[model samples]
Target chain A: MNLKRTTLIPLDDDSLAESIFKSFIEKEMMLLMVIIGDTDTIREAIPKADNLAQLSYFKMERWVLWVRNYEILSETLKKHLKASDADKSKEDYNNIKCLCFSPILDKVDGIILKNAELSYASLQQSFFKAQAHDALAVNI
Target chain B: MYYLKRISTLVLVCFTIGIQAQIISVIENDKDQKRTISLTDKQIVDINSSLEIQLSKLQLLDAIQQQFPQLKQHLELESKLIKLQQALRNQSAVISILEKQLATASEQATFFEIMNGFLTDIQNDPLLNERYNDLMAKFFSTDTFAPGTVPEPYIFSNLNNDMLQIEQELASLEADIYAVSVLAFKKDSSGGDRVHIQNYDTYTNRDYVTIKRWVTSLSTEQKQQLEALNDIAKQNNLKKTNVFNELKIKLLEEFKSITCIKDFKNNSIEFINNIQLNDVVPTEVKNKIEQLNLLITRFETLFLLLKTDMDQWQITLLLDIKSEVETIVTLLKTIDTNFSDVTTLINQTRVKTKFMPLVSEFNTCYATINKDFETLKQGAALLFNLQNNYIANKAIGTEVLAFTLDNLPDKGYINLKGTGQRKNGDELLIELVLRLPSAVENAPEQVVTIEQREFIMQLTGPRSEVAIGLIFANPINKEDLNLQNDRNFFYTPSAALLLKFGSNKSHFYNDFLDFGIGLNFATPDFNTDGTPEFGTGIITTAFKNIISAGVNYNLTLDSFYWFFGVNLPFNLPGIPINNIKN
Candidate 1:
């Protein structure tokens, strides 16, 4: 099943944002996210993400956002849906999710999710892998 | 006392006689002694010669005394004859001088008389007066003649020459009039005029050519007037033709150049400008061109505005397409039908907040384009209407000009026919219309019709081909017809035959005044009673023809029936026929 979701991340936590992006890529999930912060931090984060994957990135100082491993994301969605269904998938997702980022929670608005099962599976798998690795290290 | 005076007188006389005799004897004795004493042989011869000379002198004296009375009478007669001859020579010389003066005075008077006639004609005609004034202004300081402001010698010479030519022409005209008068007199004396009066039945007809030849002789001024009128008419025709032709050519050229809407607008503007620039163009045509230009300008402005609106709308459409493509690409990449990723994309790009305004702008642009299109359509239609009107008016003007030129009056009658349905059941029509030229230029044109004073006879029957009627209309009005005052207005009136044809019963009147015959055919109808019944009526109308009065009679037959009526025709004095001959 095709999975699409929008979630907010804190502005100061670069590691978490990077971790979230890497985890989504490993799971072959499409991750489009907005970073609400100062221009210097967003600008620094854009290059790090560019080195990791070929993606669409917009540098709006007021609202900075980036996409990573977009080709893999398209392949994953195509594999799950029929050709006709895939044609309208982008428009449907745009209709559901907000395309702006804000620093304040009140200004954040709501996160939108499409095909939530894949998003939940990708997140759960990532946590389990981390836990497994930790148990192995402790046993050694 | 008488006897004594006689006796003394007798005594005085005797004493005086005796003394005279004695003195005579002494004087004779002294003369004989003197003569004898002076005598010699030679002296005696000389004395004898002297005595003989003296005797001859006395004889000559006696003869002179006898012839003196006859000689004196002859001398007196000779002196009187010489005086009378001198007086005769003086009188002859005076007569010759007076005759020359009279001839010169007569010539000057004739010239002035002819000039006066010309001035009178000019005064009567506004156009001619204007031309005359213009011509006079060229030669004189003022149009009015003033004493001591004599024209240049050459001007006078030219005028004199022209006057002389006119004098000769007038003399020729007078001679012709005299010739015709002589002919008329001869005809009268030869019993031709009497024959017409005494034996009217035998006088078949007056030869129109001969009569016309006699009557149509024009005076010099009249000939000149006709020539001037013809010249004016020709010039007017030329002006009208030139103006219309130029307009037609210009319009055609403009139409040819107008391909696109822009070209149409530009070319139309140029055409209008060209027309405006032309001084020779008629005012109505100029006004029409101006109207056309206004319409074209409006059309161009509206069309350009519409195009600009469409351009904006198209740009907005392209932008919307780009946005749509971006949205589709995002969806393909993210597989997010719920649009959560798209919302996030929009949030990251900061484009989401601007979408509603963009959509509103697109809507506004589309609406503007539509409104502009509507305005352009209306403007285009208005422009088309102006063009059509201009073309139609041009056609009408061209036709009128052509007709005026082609149908300039010749020596013949023009017939015009018109028909109309009356509000009341009858048909008002001109069946056989006759229009005669006023016989001279500057006279009002008039038409002869049945509405004029006339006599009519009709034969009507249901079985007849048509309800046939005969009409003899009186002469046209003197003012309108321009008939000569000297002409006898009384003549056999012109005749026409009216035949009603077809179901609506249209009347077709054919003139037979020139002895031309015509026939019309129509299907016969039966009366409602199944019998062949005929119905007839008479009505009079005025202003349909030249002013006048009339009477009518009709005979209708079932087998045979008669109907009759009288109609009076009159004209309102000031009103004229709407369409008169040119």
Candidate 2:
């Protein structure tokens, strides 16, 4: 066996950054990225994703995501600042793409996801429907 | 005085002899003389005293001659010995003069060593002329230490602020790169090796741990430099901060690879190219060069001093200088570490005890650098040696064949007969591969076969050459029936040597197969209990996958081969459980 040749591929800045993120995630399993951008843009219509269900609720071992633009809240900084560069000011306008979002509470058992999202009237009706169906299913 | 003593002893001896012989002689000379009987007190006392004194003088002379035979060459040794003793009391002044001369010589040698070290330091430093002047001024001045003057605090504070600014700039740059997901940076103005640290996204393409390590090293260096300045400030009694000390200790614990070779005209042609000043060099590089110079001088001095210690070989001095060089190399590394907790912990102990941690860290970081330097050094020496012993181009063209054949004849030879050739006064490599098969009863229908792959490279020089070969075989064959008489092919090559043990190639092949003999000292392939009972030649059906039915001499044996090599491959013929519907 012999080494025939070796080639190094050139990558654009954004792609290179994504590749670096992927590599880190592969090595470390789960990592956090704090992204900063315009607040309204992030809050508008939900972001398009290839694997939404897998990402929407991270139940598996490893997951990754990009925050649209949640500007940094440091009082001294004027514009949105990347979390990694939070130590420095954002006058240079370095955007942080991914900010870590981990939920501390899991209230799914007490209040189901659908019930949690429903209004008071819809929640009451849904609760009744759940109880009735559950009782019927148990009886049968 | 000597004659008087000798005369008295002679008179006593004569008296004693006369007494013993008196009666006999008296009879013979009775009429000639009458014997005197009367004696006086003064005469007796004088005779006794003379006898005692004569005996004592004789004893003294004998003792003097025994101890100082050289002293008797010109004068009576006894008198000369007494005079010599008296002279010792008066020679204290001369002894002192000799001791003073010895001390002066020693001091002069030390001064030479120190001067050589200083010269080397100046040679290595970038600001060579300025450093030379400063060193000269410092050396010439009487006060080595300016006792009470502290360096200004504001200078260090400014340095700290500048470092902070650099850190801030780096942090900002990092954030921008992360946002953009930029993983790598193209080689810019400085060099191809440089990587922009701020962009975490681009860093994903590289080993994060390794990258983190490099950045940590640079960060630590910058921190330590600031700390050193701060230390200078503190020593001068300037106001000090706790962070500088912390930084120092951290830096001390870290080991950074040295860049001592400077630069190449290109990476390949360093021999013809001169070292450029801009290349990254090791820390304390100047001091190290000076230390090396001192060692060389010390070696030279001791070599010169061999004449003085001719009775004993001068190797003692040479050994001392070599040991000193090794110690200095270690010392330079130890001194390079920062003044952090690690440094403090190490420094708290004696120098002997403190060196352990410092050396371990330096070794860990400098491992790659040291390996590279050693390779370059060896390569340069070898190339020089080769150049000096130039070989003719015509001699290199003569090809030498190196092939290993199995004990079985025609079916087992991988050499493309005599096609090998040398090029440009260098050797070309040729490898031999062969397979042999043998059969047995009470087993699978196909006979078991052994596959041998022999790797050999023949260095055919002018008229003569050397060949080094290794053979690795799989599924080795053996003959059995009698425990002691069983013969088997070796599973691996047994020998490696640099010798010119020659034999005819044809005879080697004939004896190897016909007589069932192999290379001398070749390790046996199988033990008595495991030797296979085989007959016909075994052949492999397909490469790595299908094995020709092997005759199993013993059905109890789990694996067919008696022993296995380190590179023994384990694979079962295809029995796939899963298949795709195409």
Candidate 3:
């Protein structure tokens, strides 16, 4: 049995900063962005993530995100995915779409994603869609 | 053409009766060509962890003498914290009661004594004596009860008695079948490999060898230039610390993937094809990039320091230089990453026509920049290793180990020997130990003796590599391998090597059915009287959920007892419930 492929994710709820960098060294998880629940928290998180993205060791090909762990929150995930199929007039309709685009990454990036998968094309599309607007708020 | 590998390994056999030569080399030499080696994620993590540990070792709070202890303490406490948390959860409610009892006793002693007593009580708990037994299954064990849990069994049993006895735990014992979950030990990257030699377990720390003993070509002029580079790096321009990345990010904004598909294809072909190998593109920002090519020339001179034993001042001076070079290289990589992504976008089968010429143009420029980046990384790592003082004679060392991620193997073992301890009692030489599964975690650090011991080496990985360890048999720790317990029901010999029949595609966890017979020095037997019917106790292992149901017979008793690999949990007052260690 080849163990190099075996991935172990020890659930952590401690310091998100240490957890992110420590797990970055682990490389078992591929985190593109860190989705945050609180907008006020982005000030601290974005720089930490920026430091990670810029770290010489990480050598990130693309930028990481500071989104929500909507995928793990299954009910929130279903609401967002189903909202995309419904009317587009809802207050948070677009934010829900971006959050649902790849929600599993919220818990552990690169988990056996069943809801949706992340790739360069998909990420670029979602990124530009948000980049055109206020950058933080997903356009409804 | 996907990934060009230039693999070169230099082997200096550390221990043996005779000196042997072993080397692996690969090269399709094109000067200044890009060489990329793909590594598995696990391998990358291991290397990163190893480097992190190496860095931590250099950051001592007090002095060099105290550094080892602090680093060792930090690592041990972190790993032990996981198990300590589990034990704490197991004894949550009782902790406050125990604390109050200790608090009442503290009225007689000093605060320090009370604290010591409190710690002693927790350590002495028999149930929490996790180190002594297979409480490991509980330590890092999954908390999920989805497997083999016989739920809602509180009803229907022994209804005829004055008080009906519903023993659900015992009811499962009637079945001869056993179910056991498979678990593999995680790799401990803190430091040292704890290997068992004989009756006692001896651990050895990381060993270092010097690189390149040949005469160095570092001229007086080259040293002066490198010093200038180092000085530039040492300047703490707080505002401009991130100038290189900032400039690169701004430059990338201009080169962002052209949105219009027509412009993307046409502009890429035109812009890429227009790029000359030796010419620089027009830039509007000052990012310390103008002298990027010249910097590579300075870093390449580090390769000449093969024979030069650097003084502490020079080593410290060069670290800053290393930092500057890496900063420049990283900026270059950002460019490469963008270039590669744009090229990857167009290299699809649908656009094969523009692909070849576009790639042909891109590779020409990419090769030059890629080679310089690779060289800078190699130079930086070599300088870092020198700072760590892991040096040896260059005559025997053919290749310097690269600290960079690009060139490392997906899986391999590095043998670091513990050079004998220090003469001064106050000194702490780093102790390297290749830990086995059953190696005592809390064993007190002791002065390791120097001796070349014979070993029966076994290599096991979930993949083709079997193991990187020696074979030994101690009844106390029967089989101390990740999958060793899976082959639990066996005669553990004084020395035994695992035998496998090509099941290459299977994961390390998923067990396939197989049977083998091994000779045992001490055989086991179980008696109905709650004593081992034989001298030694029998152990059973559930392989791939295939219940190993066997009967052991003691010739003296002339009685048969059914044994299952999964020991059943029972409530008999005097008998050992799950374990029957002889």
Candidate 2: stretches off by over 4 Å: A1-140, B1-104, B123-128, B131-582
- Each candidate structure's TM-score, on Cα atoms with residue i matched to residue i, is 0.15, 0.12, 0.17
The second chain of candidate 2 has a TM-score of: 0.13
Candidate 2 residues B1-582, lDDT tens each?
999999999999988744432210100111233222111111111000000100112223333345436424322422322222222222333233323423343332332233233333333333432433344334323464242221112222332454455445444442211000111112223222212222111111221211010111235775796588668746643222233333323422331233321121122122112112313323243234334334434433442343233223122123332343344344434433421323344344333252454345444544544553344334334432332222211111111111111001111111111222111112111111111111353221221111111111211111121111222222333333233533453333222111121111222322222111111112223343454323222212111111122222223222243322221133335522121110
C-alpha displacement of B279 in model 2, angstroms? 80
Candidate 1 ranges beyond 4 A from true positions: A1-140, B1-110, B117-301, B304-582
Q: DockQ, in order, for the candidates?
A: 0.00, 0.00, 0.01
Two-way TM-score contest, 2 vs 3, winner: 3
Query: Cα RMSD for candidate 3?
Result: 37.4
Two-chain complex of model 3, DockQ on C-alpha atoms against the true structure: 0.01
Cα displacement (angstroms), candidate 3, residue B377, comes to 23
Model 3: per-residue lDDT, tens digit, B441-477?
Answer: 4332232211111111111111111111111112223
CAPRI band for model 3: incorrect
Clashes of each: 16, 32, 37
lDDT by residue for model 1 over B441-534, one digit each (tens)? 5443343321111111111111111112222222223244343433422211222222221111222321111111222111112222333222
